[model samples]
Target chain A: EIADAAEALLGAGGVKVGGALRGRHVLVTSGPTHEPIDPVRYIANRSSGKQGHAIAAAAAAAGARVTLVSGPVNLPDPAGIAVHHVETARDMLAAVEAALPADAAVFAAAVADWRVAAEAGQKLKKDGNALAPLALTENPDILAGIARRAEGRPRLVVGFAAETQNVVAHAQAKLARKGCDWIVANDVSRDGGHQSGIPGGVMGADSNAVHLVSAAGVEHWPTASKAEIAQRLVARIAVALGPQESQS
Target chain B: EIADAAEALLGAGGVKVGGALRGRHVLVTSGPTHEPIDPVRYIANRSSGKQGHAIAAAAAAAGARVTLVSGPVNLPDPAGIAVHHVETARDMLAAVEAALPADAAVFAAAVADWRVAAEAGQKLKKDGNALAPLALTENPDILAGIARRAEGRPRLVVGFAAETQNVVAHAQAKLARKGCDWIVANDVSRDGGHQSGIPGGVMGADSNAVHLVSAAGVEHWPTASKAEIAQRLVARIAVALGPQESQS
Candidate 1:
């Protein structure tokens, strides 16, 4: 890590300086969107936003101009990045679209796939009876929307797959379905693949093990801190973007 | 507050030294219970656990042996208190039941009234279609369950009501229905009635306005910091329980 930092310091001299991603614009999304059921209740995905925030921080450290659209999380905003805090999937999509035309975009948020079709204007009363089943509507597919952009599409679009079973296979399917350039997949089950040995598993754990699935093939990353995984991902992004000539 | 602390210090010389609740056991429940829809998704009430945690801290400061049963919250456990962390309302109820026969019990948790009837073991897939309405079953009413206890009932049982409208009315009804001694009720709406003027309102805010509802009637408390409200509540509890002569 020290060597990489030192090399990045000495390697670039022009408009691009410091890290390989210098002079590039990278957009990232983090945390879990909260879909409100009423004034005091909501539905949400379980996410700490650790990995996504780390990625944004790493990108910023790499000297890239970073725009981070985050959901409600306990984490502080990463330094030197444009951050937009949002609550629901619809709001997140709007924010991401507004910060567009980036070199690369990483969709790391555990956005709800569906939200309450009819959110209550007031708190629903419990009258000693069973509540009617809550109807749900599909939330916009943010990854697919950005990846399938007809105009001003980012050069690289990345998505994340948090699965309990068939991690790689599911990730591959998601990558193809979303039309994203790559998919970062991880097992989030309490047991089985990529176990962090932590009580809550990778969802909120500091460490993670992931598989990078792309058109070329699959690459299994060793268990490491979420920060380390983020740094590695940023480094890979820099490589994929290639030389300064191609960057222009 | 400083004068009160000093008075506590100067008063009492035996087992009741420092504060009125000395040598007493107080049980508190805080935060919002999460009811899982699947391995990854869940429904929850919006709560910061600040008020409940503050009450626990205040009780401990009053020299009480505090047993706090907390749901998922970002706050640290109060010093010199027995804290049991739980996720779902059922687990919270079990933990609370285990730490019973207390002098007082405070149900400050914004427990879910209902939970998904069928919790999926695996992540539910998004198969390019609208998802069916989620069936929900009623969760155990921890406050009512404890308040209605025939044996080992606490001398003082307090419940909290987070309402969007008809704050005092709802609280009064809740006190009678739950059979709890008192109800600390607050308005949690975005606008009007006890508005904290904060972005997220009273749920996660530092300050709050509450009404203490009991069979004795309602006592309106002005908007104050949650800590202040806690201290005031604890003081009332101490007074209600009366001098240590009733200790044995």
Candidate 2:
């Protein structure tokens, strides 16, 4: 049933999948994590999951045995991929760790930076005194943890830096700090508002213009459909792995 | 294509929709609002939009002309409903206001309480210094705004109280403060962790146990699937509207 839906969506969208990463295991994370505030509410991010889902679908098309650890997204599961759906960031990390031994990994989900430090088990409500103050706590750095894995880490650990300003600089620092091999950065800034003549860039938008920042330097990729970007990125990963490494 | 997927999901789940609310213009809000921090990141609440979406579907099934003003969610658009998808709380409020003169309204979205006071046009990056500090500003109170509308207010204004403890007390206060006709309060507290003993109630779960609180009194409903809860709620709303008001 899931495959049928994927096939229909792909056919309707005219998406192409290839076999560049064939015989290799590739992992992808997509969407937004919901950090629980109470049973009813949580801290989350606005991640359309388009780019990451596109990447996962593209990777699968390229013949990699793909395991997509996805956050809550509305998209139909991509064809020929094993998908693990999780709600919270903690749950997402656990799922990722369980699906290791991959040739490459992509960190694409818009994970919340922080959660309520001390969560109230009961629903927090107004008492006419004043609005409640929320204490903050940082979430686990999933990309950093995977990149710095002591053993059994994927050969290529890719991270994403979603920025509005100084894209390359932040990507470089993130690449260094997260200890990831490559960083995919895109400009998400709005000069004024989205109504300021320019289109909505990166994040929730359909088309993306990205810059690839690596230890070697920066390479700019032209604006293209998310599917195109994924296919290209997967092909690049395939090249990095080489024939011997990618083959089962 | 969206309808096809939704049909498949509904068929698989065996969800039932009816026409108790025929001809009534019922507006519903669902999901979590994204408050922009930068272009890529946002401050959001943890709302899966399941309960609200279920309600929208239920109202539509019952023959109501439903308009769902939704935030970003992965769930498929409810079949046969007009869905206005927005990202931020302000946008959501605008959408809600535009759909005015509704016969009934359900404020179910877990709107973010605050937004970044100063939005940055550029992507915020760490500059070999301390982490950036976020200044918060309050978000528009959609429920209150609608409930307190000077004119063209929906006959039945419903709000939700997702509480952990003292459910009734908080909901009563919210009812008084928000000036809504009724409030649906639910206890989302898990006795232990999600894996401990009992399953996580409400939130992202398929089943929900809730309390319908109003000026009359508190009525506890037993645990049921989200669909079942929605259908029952819509039926109750129909009765409240009475015979002359509901029919087209």
Candidate 3:
């Protein structure tokens, strides 16, 4: 059935699939990681988990048993994919570890960089005059953590870079710092309006343009729907994973 | 009021006057360049126009009277900025050239790489089993064109690479091929899923993680809101464009 669908989509130039990632275990992280400021308030991004969810869907469509470690979002679980839901960045990390021993990992989740040093169980009353600064500490970079894991490190690890200016420069830095196989850099600024809403909203926009950077060099993909991008990406991954050789 | 708002946004840290780009005109191309397959079936992306739009906003925020050549996206025009909208890649190139006398240029628009060589006057009939293969040809690389221009070449030209494999290697190649100062690379594969839409379908998501790659080295930014990312990038660009003494 899948082959027939591929044939229909690709026409005469049907996708050549010998053994591309036939039985690969792929792990994906999506949505925004929450860092608790208090029981009620937390620091998080306006990520809707649309991109990550779509990727999970695409991966499953490509025949990979996918483990989706997703953040808090209202998206329905992609059909035929296993999903684990969490809130804070710490919880996400723990979940990734539990689903480890995978062939590859894609860190698409917007993990928070800082967490309140202390979570206040109860809301504190504000003094009338001045407020003291809340202390913050850096969260563990899940991509780096997975990349530097002592055992069972996935063969390929990818990270994301969202910048407004000098996007390439910043993305290069992240590739080195995260030690991941690839980094997706984009600029998200107010003029662009973040977290707008779905279908047309921030989390579920249909189309996207991005820069794909790695040790090899850069390749620019023109604007296309997320689903199309995912299909192309999955095909590329199959090739990179030695799909043809495995099939033969 | 705009100045005050900018000052407040800048807080204590701000771009220094008389920098590398002090007198340079910078033109940035952003958003998704549309290709009219038909009036209704045009090709685009989930680009929210966020990254490119943010780049334009940030450039203006950094004291550049940026002429933001944008594509069709439901975004409010940034204040204190000049904007031009175009539909196709060819139109985009024309706009970029019109915005000439630029000191730098950032080709951030996700221009469609291929377009239907000819557009059908009306929607073609869906005859059973007889599908028309849409003839496609490559669109000119706008970044490469600007970089290789014989006359009035922008001192600094940046191109974006959206690749799925061997990202760094590919970016390096683009840097040389596009003949630009820098190349922003990203992995828009299933693993990275940078093109996801927002929830309830309203706004574009607000966070991203990326790398800044260049000849110097790669710098990584942990996951953060796109707004924060933009601020940091603008700061970097200011430094890059600033006077040698200020950069030091």
Candidate 4:
């Protein structure tokens, strides 16, 4: 019945109101990727997958078929969404590749930027003074990877800019670098009320503030709850996917 | 004694390590602003204030005397930071104005884009099929306000972009619209995995992934906790705020 309704909506679409994203496929990445430094010591970030989990749930609620390629996190799978779990950034990228031909892709996972070039099977003991420096290398940028895809690329590829100072300037540069459809720029500076502690913890102790930057222009939204922000953002997406008549 | 050491470090040109921001003044805004629909119903967003609050704490830790102007939300104030509370977007703007004349400003608050033109003191009754249409007006862009300030303007002004689609394109436009030094862009769409159902909470979350965009180029960071992101951002700010740096 839902499929039939979606087909009907798509067949005669003048201005879709009830179901804007009935046939869209959305790809999202979540949680933290672990980069192994040694047997015990690994590079990772603090992410509990709360934000990513909530985003998947919200997308499902908005009638989108979501494929959430997640990193290692202990959050229950959101109902009505397909889940693909991975551990490292490379695995997450592969999972994203498997879920290709999506209508939209959201690179939300906190991937490790660098990984130890050599992984010691055994944990290294602390040296007295002359400790060997661990050589590192850059990791693949999943957002850029998807954004720069030549085949089966999603129509909309989004990136995130977690900055401290000159937030807008950084976001502008990222827009060009990643070639994504949009960038959600945020100041993660400890002094700006962002996450400043360990990962894999809870979040949203206070309210939030954000700006929406797009080709149309920059629209600033005042402070509110993350849930409220999601609803407003979903509504905006609905409009963006709406027919020409509905836009005006 | 610490002040004298700081002066000595400045004199010796060795303060650039971690104490580069020793005496800078920073103004930050966080949380959601409410737009009253009635006494009971108001327009708002889902923001936990985690990101903003974290930024404030990080900036303070980085040696900046920070002033946090926030909208209504439940969260303990960070140590060594001055906080001002407000309710509506208008009030937040006023608070920001009152706390001005700082070296830098970060508009991280998720302000409402529109507000009811006039508040109806009494809640309207839902009697029948007929309902009153709400009339909304655009709110002021607080970041833009500070960026365009003529007198006692902050040397650096940063804004945020929370987008779902066309992220980079939108961020670039926002850079122009807000006239800010930088914009931090992120994708917070439902499938972006950065939204939580909880109204306003921020803690115990895992890693975060973000990009740093600037005139020079985009630098993408792998996912980590909000704290790590804050630390890196503060370090970047120290470099940006250093002497005779090229303006991007």
Positional deviation of residue B185's Cα in model 4 after best superposition, in angstroms: 0.7
- Ranked by TM-score, top first: 1, 2, 3, 4
Off by over 4 Å in 3: A1-19, A128-130, A190-204, A244-248, B1-248
Q: Candidate 2 lDDT, tens digit per residue, A140-177? A: 88999999999989999999877766779888999999
Candidate 1 is scored at a TM of 0.91
Error of 3 at A130 (Å): 8.7
Candidate 4 residues lying further than 4 Å off, grouped into runs, are: A1-248, B1-18, B128-130, B194-207, B243-248
Q: How much DockQ does model 4 earn?
A: 0.01
What interface Cα RMSD is found for model 3? Answer: 23.6
Model 3 agreement with the true structure over B1-248: per-residue lDDT tens digits: 32344344446654332222444466878776656443223434334667777877777766676888987666788887789988778989999999998866878776766555665433232233214343555667788899999998987787766554566777787787777877766554434434463221212456665665666655555555666555655556555554423323
Among all candidates shown, the one with the greatest lDDT: 1
Best of the two (3, 4) by TM-score: 3
User: DockQ numbers for every candidate?
Assistant: 0.66, 0.29, 0.01, 0.01
Local accuracy by lDDT, each model: 0.86, 0.77, 0.65, 0.64
- Give per-residue CA lDDT, model 1, range A1-248, as digits (tens): 43354335334431223467888899999999999998888999999999999999888888789999999999999988999999999999999999998999999999999999988877888984339889999999999999999998999999999998899999999999999998999888878434555333688888889999999889888788898788778877777776544554
Best by DockQ: 1
TM-score of chain A of each: 0.89, 0.87, 0.85, 0.81
